[model samples]
Target: MNLKGKNVLVTGSEGFIGSHLTEKLVEIGAKVTALVQYNSFNSWGWIDTFDKNIKENINIVTGDVREYDSVKRIVKGQDVVFHLAALIAIPYSYLSPMAYVKTNVQGTTNVLEACREYDVEKIIHTSTSETYGTALYVPIDEKHPLQGQSPYSASKIAADKMAESYYRSFNLPIATIRPFNTYGPRQSARAVIPTIISQVLAGKREIKLGSLSPTRDFNYVKDTAEAFIKIAESDKTIGEVINAGSNSEISIGDLAHKIIRIIGEDVKIICDKERIRPEKSEVNRLWADNTKIKQLTEWTPKYSLEEGLTETVDWIKNNMEYFKTDIYNV
Candidate 1:
C-alpha cells in the first residue's frame, strides 16, 4: 500500500509520537487529517512545533476520541486510521482510573467502530510495553502474558483486547503496533528521557527521579513512526500485534547518569518519593523481542540509544522554555 496518494487519519496528532507520525505521513505525500483534542484555547499540542510548510498540508480536526459521532466523522473517507490517542500518564491514571477507561478503552472502541463502519482498508492501533507489567522474562515478545500493574496499563490492556476482538468478530483490518518506551523531541516531562534532559539542561544540581531500578527498552520516536508506516504497508500485519523496539535495556539510574554525562553536568541523583509509583504498581523491567515486526515488515531501529539521547538533549536545550522544569508534570 503506497501512502503517496492515500488519505490518512491520525488520532492524537497533537501528541509527541502522534505529531511525529503525522509529519512523516505528510512528508511521504499522504493527505493527513490530524485529530487533536479540542480545547477552548484551540492549541494543537506538539503540532504547533511543526514547520509552516508541513502544517499547511495537514487538516486539523478538533474532537474527543471518546465521542462516537466525532470519531466516526473524522474517520470517514480515509484509507487508513492510525489511532494513537490515549491517556498515557501512569501517575495520573492512579488518581483517575475511570478517565483512563474512558479515553484508552472506550476511546479505542470508538475508533474501531468507525473503521468497521467505514470499511477502512487498514487500522493501526497503538499499544505500549507497559501492558507487559514487568519483565517476567527478558526480551518480551507478543506472547508474553499481560499483567496490568497500574491503572494506565490496565486500561491499555482492555483497549488492546478490544482491538483484537474487533479483528476476530467483525474482521476489522486491524494491526496493533506495540512500541516500547519511545523518546525524542517534543516528548513531555512525564517520560523519563525528557525529565532527565529537562532537569539537567535547566541547571539543577540535584536531579530528582523515581524508581531508579526499573529498566526499559527505549526506541527513538522516528524509528517508531517508521515502523508504523511499514506495518501499514505490509499485508501480513493484518490482525497481528507487532512490536517496535531496539531490543536494548537500560535502567532508569543508568539512563539518568548517562544523560548527565552527555550534558557534561555534575549533578547528584536524588530519589523523589512523590515522583515514584506505588511499590506494587511499578513495572520493574521491560525488554522487547522485535522479531515479529522484523519478519513482517522490513523495520529496524536506525538510531542507537546514545545517538537518540544526544538528539533529545539538543532538542531540550533549544526548547527549554516549552517545559516547566521545576514542576512535576503529571
Candidate 2:
C-alpha cells in the first residue's frame, strides 16, 4: 500500500483539504490526478496557489462528480481513489438539500461504482465529524450513533453509509476517514477560522459570528491530509471508519477571543443571527477520539492550535482580497 509509485485520483483536489492532500501525495512521489470541479474559468481553486513546480507535477481533470460517466472516465486506471468532493456548507444545505444529495451522496455512489467496475486497488472515502451531529457522549468515536441535525449532516450521513455498504455488499476496499473540524490555510470563509481571521485582518473593530457556544475539535489541515495518505497506505484501515483529529475541543467564543488576542485587536464579538444555523441543527459539541487512526496508521496531529492558527492568520492576511469580510459566506 505504499503510495510512492501508486496512481492516485483525488476527487476534490480544488478544495481546501483536498488541495493540501493532493500536494502531499505529489510530494511523496505518487502519480496524482486532481479532479477539479468543472467551471468555465477552468479554475483549480486553492490548487492554483501551489508553486509552478508542484503544479506542473499534477494531472488536472475537470468534471462533475454528480455524473457517473464523468467520474468513471477519470477513475479508470487509478490505483487509489480519494473521494473528497462535496457541498459542505450547512446553512446552504437547508436551502438546497437536493444539491447536497446529488454532490455528496450521489457523488460518493459514482466513485464507489467506478471503483468496483474498475477494480481499483483501494478507495479512501472522506467523511466529516458533522455526521455524528451533537455529541451525546464526549470524545465521539467511530461507533458513536449518527444524528443528522442539518441537511448537510444528513447528506454526509447518507454518503458515509453508502461507503460502508459498498465495503459490505460489493467488497470494495474502502476506508472512511472522518475528520473533525479541520482548519488552516486555504480554508474558505464559510468556516469559522477563516471568517474570524478575515475580519480581524480586514481591520474590523467587530467580528461577526454565529453560535459561539458550540464547541468543535479542530484539526490542522496538513495533519488531516496526512491522515488520508496514512489510511490509504494501511492494510488495517480497509473496511474501517477511522477518525483524524487532535482529540481536543474549543468553543467558538473562546476561539474567537483567542484569535483577537493573537492579532492584538480590540474587536467586539457580534452574534449575527443570519449566520446562525437553525437552533436544533447546530451541533453543540464535537470532540474526537482519534485512538483508532493512531492504532491503524502512523498518524498523529503535528500542529498545535496556536501554531496552526498563526499560520492560518498569516495566510489569510496575505490572501485578504480573496475573501469578502463584509458579507457572511454560506
Predicted structure with the largest lDDT when compared to the true one? 1
lDDT of 2 by residue, 1-330 (tens): 899989999999999999999999999999999999999998999888899999999999999999999999999999999999999988899999999999999999999999999999999999899999899998999999999999899999999999999999989999999999999988889999999989988989988999899999998899999999999999999999998989999999999999998888899999998988888888999999999999999799999999999889988888898899998888
Model 2 vs. true fold: TM: 0.99
- Candidate 1 lDDT by residue in tens digits, 48-118: 87899999999999999999999999999999999999999999998999999999999999999999999
Which whole-number lDDT from 0 to 100 does residue 210 have in model 2?
Answer: 92
- Scanning candidate 1 in windows of ten residues, the lowest lDDT window is 321-330
Name the runs in model 2 displaced over 4 angstroms.
Answer: none
* Cα shift from native, residue 316, model 1 (Å): 0.5
Deviation from native of the Cα of residue 101 in model 2, angstroms: 0.6
Cα lDDT listed for each candidate: 0.95, 0.94
